[model samples]
Target: MNSDWQIELRALRYFICVAEEKSFTRAAGRLRIAQPALSRQIKKLEEDLRVQLFIRNSRGAELTEAGEILLRRAYLIFNQVQQTHHDVTIHSRHLGGVVSVGMPPTPGEFIAPRLLERSKERYPDIELRFVEGFSGELERKLANNEIGVAVMHDPAPRDDIRISKLLVEHLCLVGRSGTLAKPEYSLAEAGSYPLVMPSRPNFLRILIDGHAERLDIPLNIVTRSDGIGHTKSLVKYGHGFTILTYGAVISEVQQGVLQAVPICNPEILWTLCVAMRTDQGRKRTLAVIEELIQEVVQELVAEGIWK
Candidate 1:
């Protein structure tokens, strides 16, 4: 293996252009350079990496397996470079911009207010926008660059997104006060109750269903709702119980409108994560806001506001 080598950013950009155009001639035209020069740069890049990047024939160039990997990494490198430039530019000016953060309904209820207050006090010029949705919806928005950051629960793995574990939260069985009649419920006991739950593909629903399946217990789902308010309403009105994080029903639990019992006997746990697009150019304001989010969550956990 060739370990001693250096590749230039210009070469990476040229290679990416060729990979996208799939023809050295076309890429050279787009780059406003001679085809021979473009080809030489690509060849040098291949030599430095000691791998065949592209296969050329009558139909121009096609990326080899190595080329595909390099292309992905090159995009990340360019994005990081662009992000650094943006950060430097912003640092020269006042730290002020619209930083959008997405969160699921449950956590948002507790996190949004404190985050907004802290951000306002610290960075008055910066505008903080909150987008509320389920984890799947938030993840989609984050990936599409519609939002700069997302706090998600048990997010699935994605190549384009970077995930950082924030905390582990236990799932609980929620019902109207004095209805559960127990301090805790086992997996099978919880599954036996008529449940009001979110539809399929919901992060919480997926976690619950997977646990039930593994335990060979069938969930008696009586109703399906995607809305957090609607689900809580149903449970409040004596429709059925639902499985959710304790944070989701904290207000109701405090008001004595609902009760939450920890799921014991192989307790169900899900990781809360902060997710951001790996290819997105992060702004300085956004970075500070992300840090603020982490700080707020940590404080909430310490205060027992988010359990």
Candidate 2:
């Protein structure tokens, strides 16, 4: 037996429409084709398979046993072909492929929604997988090819990554609302409260620790956890204060759960970057990263968090 792979999916689709509708006239209407053309495709399909596909009576055409079996198989064949074409087109045109990105949990600071919305409109079939973590973890994933792009603060040294600074802004002071009303507070004052900071080596933790060290002091960490939301929860419960890079703090500040103040005394600023794996580089991945970075920057800027 021989099979032709070159037949247009259009023919199989036309045949299925007629089989389901049971009327050439209705099938043609559904196919946006003349009735005669729809009939011809069905005839051609039956001839190709060397099988009778329909039995016509006064009421309407009904599928013969052969027609039922062929329709089932043809329906599946056409679906598989359509999906294959779709996948190939997306892979080639950057429309329907998958990309993995690492992001921090506090995604709201970046204008992520607008960027994702635009990406979907342009490439409706593209799949974006977001891996949420701090900058260090994200960079590790980028090196492993687990994520195509890492969107976080500028990473520490890693030979496998090539990073581009996308947004630079002062990391801010965040604490439970009403903790302190000062625009800038002394380290002693900032340390007076309990703190729910990330574990040592995490970006925020490192920043806070370095600042305290410079001031001849230390971070007054009440508890250490590994997640932004968990730290936020601690702040919510009045458990402790936490710091946020500008983008991380903006939305929480606006929501009134946390208040943000500018840090002073050897002021710290975080540079948000798009980190790409030198080994896993792909044009599609870069295109998506480029599209998202601007929106993230815009959001941070508009909220005055990244100023």
Candidate 3:
């Protein structure tokens, strides 16, 4: 071990580029450096770390286990350095940048407007960009760094992201006005009705299907519609009943266009979470936006606007 050897950020950047591109030749081209120089840097990095970073093969450079771990840490380091630079340069009172957020249609209906308004009121210089999609889509966007933050429902665990619970919402039985006779329905009873639901792989649909299978209830799914509006319209026009969160149809229920009944006897519940990539450190702007999301959700729940 050489006591004087110290790894530089430049070397890490070169390593990351090679790891991502999976070929030293491509990485050197992208970095605008000669291949031998790039190789020398990586060799020095490996020597400094005292671990095999990559396994060279005819195909390309594949990261070793140690390399994978280092890659994750490298991203965190890079983000932290960038955040530090931003912190020292920007004004302490004002934070500004385009922060992208993602959510499914159901939550977006209630949350987006309030979030935008609150962001504008608090951070006038900050621009809020919203991406509306299903939970799967949102997760993909988060992983790809397309969106900085996402509000997801029952998101599966992922290594690259961190999730914080926002709230737990019970599923409701939704239908045309005066269509449902009961105040609440059990899973079995809910399944007995002609159900209009999104197809398989949808987060909500998967949850319902899992419970139905466990309870041995054969759901009478009459139609499958992926669009939340289309599914709600089908129910509104007397097609069939659909299951969703009350927040999904708050306006419709309030206006007498639709009715939402809670599901009991083992309540169907889903958790809403604020998710961000682990590599995206808590920068000032992102941290502020995250706090605002929590505050907005708390206020909405407190005001009885979101259930």
Candidate 4:
């Protein structure tokens, strides 16, 4: 609200440090500036605002009411400036920089290795970090800017986020090898088998459960798992069957440790999406990474690695 006060950001920063520390000497020490210079900057700041910002004494300086107001506004201003700088820096980066991408455990396990290898081959200077978690967690990380982009599932329609459909992967019933003679199943028939499934709130579980609900069929879920590894382990050992996209169990199925049967009453499909903040939707790095992921997914699908 101090419209007439044309204050330098550096001086505002100095004033904030003094206000927070309540001691000019300590603030100057923290700022690595001479105490006298810090004092002059704060004094100039006060003159610009035409108000007493601090009650100075030998012991310390306490903020006046105006100082408190500036403190609040300055905090907001500095935060915005920092965020702008970060975004601008990211946008300005060329072929070399760090980017974080989030993915669910299943796709992450399959995609991360190929993505890293290809990135090393193509964009060797660009450092890549992959964060693997459930879709719910990945979405939260994307929203908070903890990740630059995410490969996730069922990205609901939202104003602040932009989603691109990368794949509509077919879900199949998986179990210990030789347990099922045929490699195809109706959702109703699949419901008869005991299931090992991720608990509710998991995207896969939600999708599977929704299908069951829609068909008025109850799944005989024998055990619950929050992790893809555990879910695969449970199915491999003949404990029970589980539903997942073919890419998730391709290796196991090929090794004869697990057999997959496509679910076909409605043909369960897992819709994978690449999601990013709408504001940064046009970022070059994001576009490159997204394109690479789509390429990898299509290659897998084409080669029958992911069905």
What candidate 4 gets wrong by more than 4 Å, as runs, is 1-93
Task: Give the candidate number with the greatest lDDT.
Answer: 3
lDDT for model 3, on a 0 to 1 scale? 0.88
lDDT of 1 at 180: 87
Q: Give the per-residue lDDT of model 4 (tens digit) for 1-307.
A: 3687675799988987898689999999999999999999988887778899999888799898999888877756664564565577775655556677898877887788999998888888777977788888888767766677799999778888889888898888888989988869999888889999888888888888899999899898889988889889988878899888888888887888998888898888889988888876656666788788988888877886666
Model 4, position 172: C-alpha lDDT score: 87
Instruction: Report the lDDT of model 4 for residue 18.
Output: 94
Q: What is the lDDT of residue 31 in candidate 2?
A: 79
Itemize residue pairs with steric clashes in candidate 4: none
**Residue-pair clashes per candidate:** 0, 0, 0, 0
For lDDT, candidate 2 versus 3, the one ahead is: 3
Residue 220's C-alpha lDDT in candidate 1?
90
- How do the candidates rank by lDDT, highest first? 3, 1, 4, 2
- Pairwise lDDT winner, candidates 1 and 2: 1
lDDT for 105 in candidate 4 is 78
lDDT of each: 0.85, 0.70, 0.88, 0.83
RMSD in angstroms between candidate 2 and the native structure over all alpha carbons: 14.3
Predicted structure 1: lDDT = 0.85
RMSD of 1: 11.6
Deviation of model 4 at 243, angstroms: 1.0
Go through the candidates in order and give the C-alpha RMSD of each one to the true structure.
Answer: 11.6, 14.3, 9.2, 10.8
* TM-score of predicted structure 3: 0.71
Window of ten residues with lowest summed lDDT in model 2: 78-87
